[model samples]
Target: MDKIQRNERLSVIIKTLCDNPNKVFTLGYFSEMFGSAKSTISEDLDLLQKTFKKNSMGNICTIAGASGGVKYIPSVSEMDVRETLEELAKELSHPDRILSGGFLYMLDIIYNPKWVNKVAMIFATKFSGLGIDCVITVETKGIPIAFATAQYLNVPLVIVRHNNEATDGASVNINYASGSAKKIQTMVLPMKSLKRNSKILFIDDFMKAGGTSKGIIELANQFDSKVVGIGVMIETGLPVKKLVGNYHSLMKLNTSEMQENNSIDIKPNI
Candidate 1:
Protein backbone atom coordinates (compact mmCIF):
# COMPACT_ATOMS: atom_id res chain seq x y z
CA MET A 1 0.00 0.00 0.00
CA ASP A 2 1.23 3.51 -0.84
CA LYS A 3 2.07 5.71 2.17
CA ILE A 4 -0.72 8.22 2.68
CA GLN A 5 0.18 11.94 2.55
CA ARG A 6 -0.22 14.44 5.41
CA ASN A 7 -3.57 16.05 4.42
CA GLU A 8 -5.20 12.71 3.67
CA ARG A 9 -3.90 11.23 6.91
CA LEU A 10 -5.27 14.11 8.96
CA SER A 11 -8.69 13.85 7.32
CA VAL A 12 -8.91 10.11 7.82
CA ILE A 13 -7.78 10.34 11.44
CA ILE A 14 -10.32 13.03 12.19
CA LYS A 15 -13.11 11.08 10.56
CA THR A 16 -12.16 7.89 12.33
CA LEU A 17 -11.94 9.62 15.71
CA CYS A 18 -15.29 11.30 15.13
CA ASP A 19 -16.94 8.04 14.18
CA ASN A 20 -15.95 6.69 17.57
CA PRO A 21 -16.34 9.48 20.09
CA ASN A 22 -15.33 8.97 23.73
CA LYS A 23 -13.24 5.99 22.58
CA VAL A 24 -9.46 5.96 22.74
CA PHE A 25 -7.40 5.41 19.61
CA THR A 26 -3.75 4.66 20.18
CA LEU A 27 -0.95 6.47 18.36
CA GLY A 28 0.50 3.13 17.25
CA TYR A 29 -2.74 2.19 15.55
CA PHE A 30 -2.62 5.26 13.36
CA SER A 31 1.08 4.84 12.69
CA GLU A 32 0.60 1.23 11.59
CA MET A 33 -2.41 2.08 9.47
CA PHE A 34 -0.58 4.72 7.47
CA GLY A 35 2.91 3.14 7.66
CA SER A 36 4.04 6.30 9.44
CA ALA A 37 6.17 6.51 12.57
CA LYS A 38 4.62 7.18 15.98
CA SER A 39 6.34 10.55 16.07
CA THR A 40 4.73 11.55 12.76
CA ILE A 41 1.29 10.46 13.98
CA SER A 42 1.76 12.44 17.18
CA GLU A 43 2.56 15.54 15.17
CA ASP A 44 -0.57 15.01 13.08
CA LEU A 45 -2.69 14.67 16.23
CA ASP A 46 -1.26 17.85 17.71
CA LEU A 47 -2.22 19.71 14.58
CA LEU A 48 -5.70 18.17 14.57
CA GLN A 49 -6.30 19.00 18.21
CA LYS A 50 -5.14 22.55 17.70
CA THR A 51 -7.39 22.99 14.69
CA PHE A 52 -10.42 21.69 16.59
CA LYS A 53 -9.74 23.95 19.55
CA LYS A 54 -9.12 26.96 17.32
CA ASN A 55 -12.42 26.44 15.51
CA SER A 56 -14.37 25.67 18.71
CA MET A 57 -15.47 22.55 16.84
CA GLY A 58 -14.85 19.86 19.49
CA ASN A 59 -12.10 18.32 21.59
CA ILE A 60 -9.46 15.61 21.17
CA CYS A 61 -8.16 14.59 24.54
CA THR A 62 -4.75 12.97 24.70
CA ILE A 63 -3.88 10.60 27.50
CA ALA A 64 -0.21 10.15 28.43
CA GLY A 65 0.80 6.57 29.20
CA ALA A 66 1.88 3.34 27.55
CA SER A 67 -1.80 2.37 27.20
CA GLY A 68 -2.99 5.93 26.66
CA GLY A 69 -4.45 7.28 23.44
CA VAL A 70 -6.72 10.03 22.17
CA LYS A 71 -10.48 10.35 22.56
CA TYR A 72 -12.83 12.55 20.55
CA ILE A 73 -15.50 14.59 22.37
CA PRO A 74 -17.99 16.39 20.20
CA SER A 75 -18.72 19.81 21.64
CA VAL A 76 -20.94 22.63 20.48
CA SER A 77 -20.12 26.16 21.56
CA GLU A 78 -22.47 27.72 24.11
CA MET A 79 -22.99 30.69 21.84
CA ASP A 80 -24.03 28.43 18.99
CA VAL A 81 -26.33 26.45 21.24
CA ARG A 82 -27.95 29.59 22.51
CA GLU A 83 -28.47 30.95 19.04
CA THR A 84 -29.89 27.72 17.70
CA LEU A 85 -32.29 27.23 20.63
CA GLU A 86 -33.39 30.82 20.43
CA GLU A 87 -34.34 30.17 16.82
CA LEU A 88 -36.16 27.04 17.91
CA ALA A 89 -37.98 29.00 20.55
CA LYS A 90 -39.14 31.45 17.94
CA GLU A 91 -40.28 28.65 15.70
CA LEU A 92 -42.12 27.00 18.55
CA SER A 93 -43.95 30.18 19.48
CA HIS A 94 -45.90 29.96 16.25
CA PRO A 95 -49.66 29.65 16.71
CA ASP A 96 -49.98 26.84 14.20
CA ARG A 97 -47.63 24.72 16.28
CA ILE A 98 -50.08 24.90 19.17
CA LEU A 99 -52.61 22.12 19.32
CA SER A 100 -56.17 22.23 20.66
CA GLY A 101 -55.27 20.55 23.95
CA GLY A 102 -52.44 23.03 24.61
CA PHE A 103 -49.80 20.66 23.30
CA LEU A 104 -47.06 21.79 20.95
CA TYR A 105 -46.65 20.05 17.64
CA MET A 106 -43.17 18.57 17.91
CA LEU A 107 -43.11 15.50 15.70
CA ASP A 108 -41.17 17.38 13.04
CA ILE A 109 -38.52 18.65 15.43
CA ILE A 110 -38.24 15.31 17.23
CA TYR A 111 -37.72 13.52 13.92
CA ASN A 112 -35.29 16.06 12.53
CA PRO A 113 -31.80 14.73 13.18
CA LYS A 114 -30.25 18.17 13.18
CA TRP A 115 -32.44 19.53 15.99
CA VAL A 116 -32.72 16.27 17.92
CA ASN A 117 -28.93 15.84 18.14
CA LYS A 118 -28.39 19.36 19.37
CA VAL A 119 -31.04 18.96 22.05
CA ALA A 120 -29.66 15.60 23.08
CA MET A 121 -26.15 17.01 23.38
CA ILE A 122 -27.41 19.65 25.74
CA PHE A 123 -29.00 17.00 27.97
CA ALA A 124 -26.02 14.68 27.68
CA THR A 125 -23.67 17.48 28.66
CA LYS A 126 -25.68 18.23 31.77
CA PHE A 127 -25.62 14.63 32.98
CA SER A 128 -22.34 13.39 31.49
CA GLY A 129 -20.39 13.65 34.73
CA LEU A 130 -22.93 11.53 36.57
CA GLY A 131 -22.50 7.78 36.98
CA ILE A 132 -25.16 6.94 34.44
CA ASP A 133 -25.54 3.23 33.67
CA CYS A 134 -28.08 3.73 30.89
CA VAL A 135 -30.45 6.24 29.32
CA ILE A 136 -34.23 5.84 29.73
CA THR A 137 -37.24 7.37 28.03
CA VAL A 138 -40.83 6.41 27.50
CA GLU A 139 -42.37 5.46 24.21
CA THR A 140 -43.20 7.87 21.35
CA LYS A 141 -41.58 11.32 21.10
CA GLY A 142 -38.87 10.82 23.66
CA ILE A 143 -37.13 7.95 21.84
CA PRO A 144 -34.97 10.06 19.53
CA ILE A 145 -33.70 12.36 22.24
CA ALA A 146 -33.03 9.42 24.54
CA PHE A 147 -31.10 7.57 21.84
CA ALA A 148 -28.99 10.61 21.07
CA THR A 149 -28.17 11.14 24.72
CA ALA A 150 -27.18 7.50 25.04
CA GLN A 151 -24.97 7.83 21.97
CA TYR A 152 -23.05 10.73 23.44
CA LEU A 153 -22.75 9.09 26.84
CA ASN A 154 -21.79 5.72 25.34
CA VAL A 155 -24.52 4.00 27.38
CA PRO A 156 -27.38 1.66 26.64
CA LEU A 157 -30.88 3.02 25.98
CA VAL A 158 -33.84 1.55 27.85
CA ILE A 159 -37.32 2.42 26.73
CA VAL A 160 -40.45 2.16 28.82
CA ARG A 161 -43.62 1.31 26.97
CA HIS A 162 -47.13 2.67 27.43
CA ASN A 163 -48.39 -0.86 26.97
CA ASN A 164 -46.89 -4.29 27.03
CA GLU A 165 -45.82 -5.04 23.44
CA ALA A 166 -45.39 -8.69 24.54
CA THR A 167 -42.08 -8.96 22.67
CA ASP A 168 -40.40 -7.57 25.77
CA GLY A 169 -41.23 -10.82 27.62
CA ALA A 170 -41.82 -10.76 31.36
CA SER A 171 -42.11 -7.10 32.38
CA VAL A 172 -42.83 -4.96 35.43
CA ASN A 173 -45.78 -2.68 35.02
CA ILE A 174 -46.66 0.45 37.00
CA ASN A 175 -49.50 2.94 36.86
CA TYR A 176 -48.61 6.61 37.01
CA ALA A 177 -50.53 9.82 36.56
CA SER A 178 -49.99 11.91 33.47
CA GLY A 179 -48.97 15.40 34.50
CA SER A 180 -50.92 17.19 31.84
CA ALA A 181 -53.82 14.84 31.34
CA LYS A 182 -54.25 14.30 35.08
CA LYS A 183 -55.25 10.70 34.32
CA ILE A 184 -53.67 7.48 35.48
CA GLN A 185 -51.69 5.59 32.84
CA THR A 186 -49.79 2.36 32.68
CA MET A 187 -46.03 2.33 31.92
CA VAL A 188 -44.20 -0.92 31.46
CA LEU A 189 -40.51 -1.75 31.45
CA PRO A 190 -38.98 -5.12 30.69
CA MET A 191 -37.62 -6.89 33.74
CA LYS A 192 -34.30 -7.49 32.01
CA SER A 193 -34.01 -3.97 30.69
CA LEU A 194 -32.14 -2.66 33.70
CA LYS A 195 -30.14 -4.23 36.45
CA ARG A 196 -30.74 -3.73 40.13
CA ASN A 197 -28.84 -0.82 41.70
CA SER A 198 -28.05 0.61 38.26
CA LYS A 199 -27.85 4.35 37.85
CA ILE A 200 -30.31 5.70 35.30
CA LEU A 201 -30.63 8.93 33.36
CA PHE A 202 -34.11 9.86 32.17
CA ILE A 203 -34.53 11.95 29.02
CA ASP A 204 -37.86 13.14 27.72
CA ASP A 205 -39.20 15.57 25.13
CA PHE A 206 -41.61 17.44 27.39
CA MET A 207 -42.51 17.96 31.03
CA LYS A 208 -45.77 19.44 32.12
CA ALA A 209 -46.21 19.07 35.86
CA GLY A 210 -43.54 16.37 36.24
CA GLY A 211 -45.98 13.52 36.70
CA THR A 212 -44.09 11.38 34.21
CA SER A 213 -40.79 12.02 35.89
CA LYS A 214 -42.23 11.17 39.26
CA GLY A 215 -43.62 7.99 37.77
CA ILE A 216 -40.23 7.15 36.34
CA ILE A 217 -38.70 7.55 39.76
CA GLU A 218 -41.22 5.11 41.17
CA LEU A 219 -40.71 2.70 38.28
CA ALA A 220 -36.95 2.77 38.78
CA ASN A 221 -37.53 1.90 42.39
CA GLN A 222 -39.32 -1.26 41.32
CA PHE A 223 -36.05 -2.55 39.86
CA ASP A 224 -34.06 -1.23 42.82
CA SER A 225 -32.23 1.14 40.47
CA LYS A 226 -31.51 4.78 41.15
CA VAL A 227 -32.46 7.60 38.81
CA VAL A 228 -29.49 9.93 38.77
CA GLY A 229 -30.98 12.65 36.64
CA ILE A 230 -33.98 13.81 34.61
CA GLY A 231 -33.80 16.02 31.54
CA VAL A 232 -36.60 17.51 29.48
CA MET A 233 -36.47 19.41 26.21
CA ILE A 234 -39.40 21.71 26.94
CA GLU A 235 -41.02 22.42 30.32
CA THR A 236 -44.05 24.42 31.25
CA GLY A 237 -43.33 27.49 33.31
CA LEU A 238 -46.69 27.69 35.00
CA PRO A 239 -48.27 25.23 37.46
CA VAL A 240 -45.14 25.77 39.48
CA LYS A 241 -45.85 22.92 41.88
CA LYS A 242 -44.59 19.96 39.90
CA LEU A 243 -44.71 16.36 41.10
CA VAL A 244 -41.02 16.05 40.44
CA GLY A 245 -38.69 18.79 41.62
CA ASN A 246 -35.29 17.91 40.26
CA TYR A 247 -34.83 18.19 36.52
CA HIS A 248 -32.92 20.12 33.89
CA SER A 249 -34.83 21.79 31.09
CA LEU A 250 -33.45 23.13 27.83
CA MET A 251 -36.36 25.42 27.04
CA LYS A 252 -39.15 26.96 29.15
CA LEU A 253 -42.49 27.07 27.40
CA ASN A 254 -44.43 30.04 28.72
CA THR A 255 -48.03 29.50 27.77
CA SER A 256 -49.12 32.57 29.71
CA GLU A 257 -47.90 34.72 26.83
CA MET A 258 -50.56 33.28 24.58
CA GLN A 259 -52.15 36.44 23.19
CA GLU A 260 -55.29 36.88 21.17
CA ASN A 261 -53.11 36.76 18.05
CA ASN A 262 -51.91 33.31 19.11
CA SER A 263 -48.24 33.82 20.00
CA ILE A 264 -46.71 31.79 22.81
CA ASP A 265 -43.44 32.78 24.43
CA ILE A 266 -40.45 30.46 24.26
CA LYS A 267 -37.29 31.05 26.21
CA PRO A 268 -34.02 29.19 26.53
CA ASN A 269 -33.33 27.94 30.02
CA ILE A 270 -29.59 28.09 29.45
Candidate 2:
Protein backbone atom coordinates (compact mmCIF):
# COMPACT_ATOMS: atom_id res chain seq x y z
CA MET A 1 0.00 0.00 0.00
CA ASP A 2 1.06 3.54 -0.65
CA LYS A 3 1.74 6.00 2.19
CA ILE A 4 -1.76 7.50 1.85
CA GLN A 5 -3.30 4.02 1.80
CA ARG A 6 -1.39 3.08 4.95
CA ASN A 7 -2.64 6.17 6.78
CA GLU A 8 -6.24 5.39 5.80
CA ARG A 9 -5.81 1.78 6.91
CA LEU A 10 -4.39 2.91 10.24
CA SER A 11 -7.38 5.21 10.73
CA VAL A 12 -9.77 2.32 10.08
CA ILE A 13 -7.98 0.16 12.66
CA ILE A 14 -8.10 2.96 15.22
CA LYS A 15 -11.83 3.45 14.59
CA THR A 16 -12.42 -0.22 15.24
CA LEU A 17 -10.63 0.04 18.58
CA CYS A 18 -12.86 2.97 19.51
CA ASP A 19 -16.01 1.06 18.62
CA ASN A 20 -15.27 -1.90 20.89
CA PRO A 21 -14.88 -0.76 24.51
CA ASN A 22 -13.77 -3.96 26.23
CA LYS A 23 -11.70 -5.11 23.25
CA VAL A 24 -7.94 -4.70 23.27
CA PHE A 25 -5.58 -5.18 20.32
CA THR A 26 -1.91 -6.05 20.61
CA LEU A 27 0.90 -4.27 18.71
CA GLY A 28 1.91 -7.53 17.05
CA TYR A 29 -1.57 -7.93 15.60
CA PHE A 30 -1.48 -4.51 13.94
CA SER A 31 2.09 -4.97 12.72
CA GLU A 32 1.08 -8.11 10.85
CA MET A 33 -2.13 -6.58 9.50
CA PHE A 34 -0.42 -3.60 7.86
CA GLY A 35 2.83 -5.44 7.01
CA SER A 36 4.69 -2.76 8.98
CA ALA A 37 7.32 -2.89 11.68
CA LYS A 38 6.37 -2.67 15.36
CA SER A 39 7.86 0.83 15.59
CA THR A 40 5.81 2.03 12.61
CA ILE A 41 2.64 0.52 14.04
CA SER A 42 3.32 2.20 17.37
CA GLU A 43 3.83 5.56 15.66
CA ASP A 44 0.55 5.17 13.80
CA LEU A 45 -1.31 4.38 17.03
CA ASP A 46 0.31 7.34 18.73
CA LEU A 47 -0.75 9.64 15.91
CA LEU A 48 -4.29 8.30 16.02
CA GLN A 49 -4.53 8.88 19.77
CA LYS A 50 -3.19 12.43 19.53
CA THR A 51 -5.47 13.28 16.62
CA PHE A 52 -8.54 11.84 18.37
CA LYS A 53 -7.85 13.72 21.59
CA LYS A 54 -7.17 16.96 19.71
CA ASN A 55 -10.64 16.64 18.14
CA SER A 56 -12.26 16.20 21.60
CA MET A 57 -13.67 12.84 20.51
CA GLY A 58 -12.20 10.37 23.07
CA ASN A 59 -8.98 8.81 24.33
CA ILE A 60 -6.80 5.76 23.66
CA CYS A 61 -6.01 3.68 26.74
CA THR A 62 -2.91 1.47 26.86
CA ILE A 63 -2.75 -1.41 29.34
CA ALA A 64 0.65 -2.50 30.62
CA GLY A 65 0.85 -6.20 31.50
CA ALA A 66 1.80 -9.54 30.05
CA SER A 67 -1.53 -9.66 28.18
CA GLY A 68 -1.94 -5.91 27.78
CA GLY A 69 -3.23 -4.08 24.66
CA VAL A 70 -4.60 -0.74 23.49
CA LYS A 71 -8.26 0.32 23.74
CA TYR A 72 -10.23 3.42 22.76
CA ILE A 73 -12.59 5.10 25.20
CA PRO A 74 -15.31 7.59 24.28
CA SER A 75 -15.05 10.76 26.35
CA VAL A 76 -16.92 13.61 24.69
CA SER A 77 -16.67 16.92 26.57
CA GLU A 78 -19.55 18.64 28.37
CA MET A 79 -20.26 21.12 25.55
CA ASP A 80 -20.51 18.28 23.03
CA VAL A 81 -22.92 16.48 25.33
CA ARG A 82 -25.46 19.31 25.11
CA GLU A 83 -25.14 19.66 21.37
CA THR A 84 -25.52 15.94 20.81
CA LEU A 85 -28.54 15.72 23.11
CA GLU A 86 -30.22 18.59 21.30
CA GLU A 87 -29.76 16.88 17.96
CA LEU A 88 -31.10 13.62 19.34
CA ALA A 89 -34.11 15.39 20.82
CA LYS A 90 -35.00 16.80 17.43
CA GLU A 91 -34.70 13.41 15.79
CA LEU A 92 -36.80 11.68 18.44
CA SER A 93 -39.58 14.26 18.40
CA HIS A 94 -40.49 13.86 14.72
CA PRO A 95 -44.16 13.62 13.91
CA ASP A 96 -43.93 10.25 12.15
CA ARG A 97 -42.72 8.47 15.28
CA ILE A 98 -45.57 6.67 17.01
CA LEU A 99 -45.55 5.49 20.60
CA SER A 100 -48.24 2.99 21.50
CA GLY A 101 -49.55 2.37 25.02
CA GLY A 102 -46.82 4.49 26.64
CA PHE A 103 -44.01 2.41 25.18
CA LEU A 104 -41.68 3.76 22.51
CA TYR A 105 -40.16 1.52 19.83
CA MET A 106 -36.64 2.09 21.08
CA LEU A 107 -35.66 -1.57 21.13
CA ASP A 108 -33.67 -1.07 17.95
CA ILE A 109 -31.40 1.29 19.83
CA ILE A 110 -31.11 -0.72 23.04
CA TYR A 111 -30.52 -4.02 21.24
CA ASN A 112 -27.51 -2.57 19.46
CA PRO A 113 -24.69 -4.14 21.46
CA LYS A 114 -21.97 -1.85 20.13
CA TRP A 115 -23.76 1.38 21.01
CA VAL A 116 -25.00 0.03 24.34
CA ASN A 117 -21.52 -1.18 25.28
CA LYS A 118 -20.10 2.26 24.63
CA VAL A 119 -22.80 3.78 26.79
CA ALA A 120 -22.19 1.35 29.67
CA MET A 121 -18.44 1.98 29.60
CA ILE A 122 -19.04 5.71 29.88
CA PHE A 123 -21.43 5.21 32.82
CA ALA A 124 -19.13 2.75 34.56
CA THR A 125 -16.28 5.26 34.43
CA LYS A 126 -18.40 8.12 35.71
CA PHE A 127 -19.81 6.09 38.63
CA SER A 128 -16.75 3.97 39.40
CA GLY A 129 -15.94 6.04 42.48
CA LEU A 130 -19.52 6.31 43.69
CA GLY A 131 -19.48 3.14 45.84
CA ILE A 132 -21.74 1.16 43.53
CA ASP A 133 -22.07 -2.52 44.41
CA CYS A 134 -24.62 -3.68 41.85
CA VAL A 135 -26.74 -2.73 38.82
CA ILE A 136 -30.54 -3.15 38.66
CA THR A 137 -33.11 -2.91 35.86
CA VAL A 138 -36.69 -3.88 35.10
CA GLU A 139 -36.83 -7.10 33.17
CA THR A 140 -36.86 -7.96 29.44
CA LYS A 141 -35.48 -5.20 27.23
CA GLY A 142 -33.23 -3.52 29.76
CA ILE A 143 -31.70 -6.87 30.75
CA PRO A 144 -29.08 -6.96 27.97
CA ILE A 145 -27.66 -3.47 28.49
CA ALA A 146 -27.81 -3.83 32.25
CA PHE A 147 -25.92 -7.08 31.93
CA ALA A 148 -23.29 -5.34 29.83
CA THR A 149 -22.81 -2.67 32.48
CA ALA A 150 -22.58 -5.26 35.21
CA GLN A 151 -20.03 -7.18 33.19
CA TYR A 152 -17.90 -4.06 32.84
CA LEU A 153 -18.12 -3.24 36.54
CA ASN A 154 -17.76 -6.85 37.60
CA VAL A 155 -20.95 -6.54 39.63
CA PRO A 156 -24.03 -8.72 39.89
CA LEU A 157 -27.29 -7.69 38.20
CA VAL A 158 -30.75 -7.66 39.81
CA ILE A 159 -33.70 -7.98 37.49
CA VAL A 160 -37.12 -6.54 38.33
CA ARG A 161 -39.81 -8.42 36.51
CA HIS A 162 -43.23 -7.15 35.57
CA ASN A 163 -44.93 -9.81 37.66
CA ASN A 164 -44.11 -12.66 39.97
CA GLU A 165 -44.13 -15.56 37.56
CA ALA A 166 -43.56 -19.13 38.68
CA THR A 167 -40.22 -19.08 36.89
CA ASP A 168 -38.77 -16.64 39.39
CA GLY A 169 -39.09 -19.13 42.28
CA ALA A 170 -40.78 -17.11 45.04
CA SER A 171 -40.15 -13.57 43.93
CA VAL A 172 -41.35 -10.48 45.74
CA ASN A 173 -44.06 -8.46 44.05
CA ILE A 174 -45.03 -4.86 44.76
CA ASN A 175 -47.81 -2.64 43.42
CA TYR A 176 -46.97 0.83 42.19
CA ALA A 177 -48.44 3.43 39.82
CA SER A 178 -47.24 3.17 36.24
CA GLY A 179 -46.04 6.10 34.22
CA SER A 180 -48.80 6.52 31.64
CA ALA A 181 -51.72 4.57 33.13
CA LYS A 182 -51.57 6.39 36.45
CA LYS A 183 -52.87 3.09 37.83
CA ILE A 184 -51.17 0.40 39.84
CA GLN A 185 -49.19 -2.42 38.23
CA THR A 186 -47.26 -5.27 39.78
CA MET A 187 -43.46 -5.19 39.70
CA VAL A 188 -41.40 -8.09 41.00
CA LEU A 189 -37.78 -8.69 41.86
CA PRO A 190 -36.29 -12.02 42.78
CA MET A 191 -35.24 -12.31 46.39
CA LYS A 192 -31.58 -13.08 47.23
CA SER A 193 -30.47 -11.10 44.19
CA LEU A 194 -29.29 -8.25 46.38
CA LYS A 195 -28.18 -7.64 49.95
CA ARG A 196 -28.43 -4.96 52.62
CA ASN A 197 -26.69 -1.57 52.51
CA SER A 198 -25.43 -2.20 48.96
CA LYS A 199 -25.35 0.67 46.51
CA ILE A 200 -27.37 -0.11 43.37
CA LEU A 201 -27.41 1.58 39.97
CA PHE A 202 -30.70 1.52 38.04
CA ILE A 203 -30.55 0.90 34.28
CA ASP A 204 -33.47 1.02 31.87
CA ASP A 205 -34.01 1.18 28.13
CA PHE A 206 -36.29 4.18 28.31
CA MET A 207 -37.78 6.55 30.89
CA LYS A 208 -40.95 8.65 30.58
CA ALA A 209 -42.58 9.55 33.89
CA GLY A 210 -40.21 7.33 35.90
CA GLY A 211 -43.05 5.56 37.71
CA THR A 212 -41.37 2.21 37.11
CA SER A 213 -38.06 3.68 38.18
CA LYS A 214 -39.63 4.72 41.47
CA GLY A 215 -41.04 1.21 41.89
CA ILE A 216 -37.55 -0.24 41.56
CA ILE A 217 -36.41 2.16 44.26
CA GLU A 218 -39.14 0.90 46.61
CA LEU A 219 -38.22 -2.69 45.84
CA ALA A 220 -34.59 -1.97 46.58
CA ASN A 221 -35.68 -0.63 49.96
CA GLN A 222 -37.04 -4.05 50.94
CA PHE A 223 -33.47 -5.37 50.96
CA ASP A 224 -32.07 -2.28 52.66
CA SER A 225 -30.29 -1.36 49.42
CA LYS A 226 -29.70 2.23 48.40
CA VAL A 227 -30.06 3.42 44.81
CA VAL A 228 -26.84 5.20 43.89
CA GLY A 229 -27.85 6.39 40.42
CA ILE A 230 -30.30 6.01 37.55
CA GLY A 231 -29.51 5.70 33.82
CA VAL A 232 -31.66 5.45 30.72
CA MET A 233 -30.78 4.77 27.12
CA ILE A 234 -33.46 7.16 26.00
CA GLU A 235 -35.62 9.63 27.95
CA THR A 236 -38.81 11.05 26.44
CA GLY A 237 -39.04 14.71 27.35
CA LEU A 238 -42.41 15.19 29.01
CA PRO A 239 -44.06 17.63 31.33
CA VAL A 240 -44.41 15.10 34.12
CA LYS A 241 -41.96 15.24 36.99
CA LYS A 242 -39.55 12.30 37.25
CA LEU A 243 -40.02 10.05 40.28
CA VAL A 244 -36.47 8.69 40.38
CA GLY A 245 -33.82 11.39 40.32
CA ASN A 246 -30.02 11.31 39.98
CA TYR A 247 -30.18 10.21 36.39
CA HIS A 248 -28.11 10.14 33.21
CA SER A 249 -29.30 9.67 29.64
CA LEU A 250 -27.69 9.22 26.24
CA MET A 251 -30.50 10.77 24.22
CA LYS A 252 -33.89 12.45 24.71
CA LEU A 253 -36.83 11.42 22.54
CA ASN A 254 -38.65 14.62 21.80
CA THR A 255 -41.24 12.57 19.77
CA SER A 256 -41.92 15.62 17.64
CA GLU A 257 -39.15 15.16 15.08
CA MET A 258 -39.17 11.44 14.38
CA GLN A 259 -39.00 10.74 10.66
CA GLU A 260 -40.44 8.03 8.44
CA ASN A 261 -39.01 4.51 7.87
CA ASN A 262 -37.85 4.29 11.51
CA SER A 263 -34.49 5.83 10.70
CA ILE A 264 -33.72 8.11 13.64
CA ASP A 265 -30.77 10.49 13.62
CA ILE A 266 -29.53 10.16 17.17
CA LYS A 267 -27.04 12.61 18.60
CA PRO A 268 -24.78 11.12 21.27
CA ASN A 269 -25.53 12.98 24.50
CA ILE A 270 -22.73 11.38 26.54
Q: For each candidate in turn, give its C-alpha RMSD to the true structure in angstroms.
A: 2.3, 6.9
lDDT of 1 by residue, 1-270 (tens): 234599899999999998876778999999999989999889999999999999987888899999999988777788878987898888787779877655678799987998999888877667876879999999889999999989887789999998897688999999998887889999999998899998999999988899999999999999999899999999988788888878888899777665333567789987
**Decoy 2 TM-score against native:** 0.63
C-alpha lDDT score of every prediction, in listed order: 0.87, 0.73
Q: What are the runs in model 2 whose C-alpha is more than 4 Å off?
A: 1-104, 256-270
lDDT of 1: 0.87
Clashes of each: 0, 9
Note the residue pairs that clash in candidate 1.
none
* Cα deviation of 131, candidate 2, in Å: 1.7
Measured by TM-score, the strongest candidate is: 1
TM-score, predicted candidate 1 vs. hidden true structure: 0.91
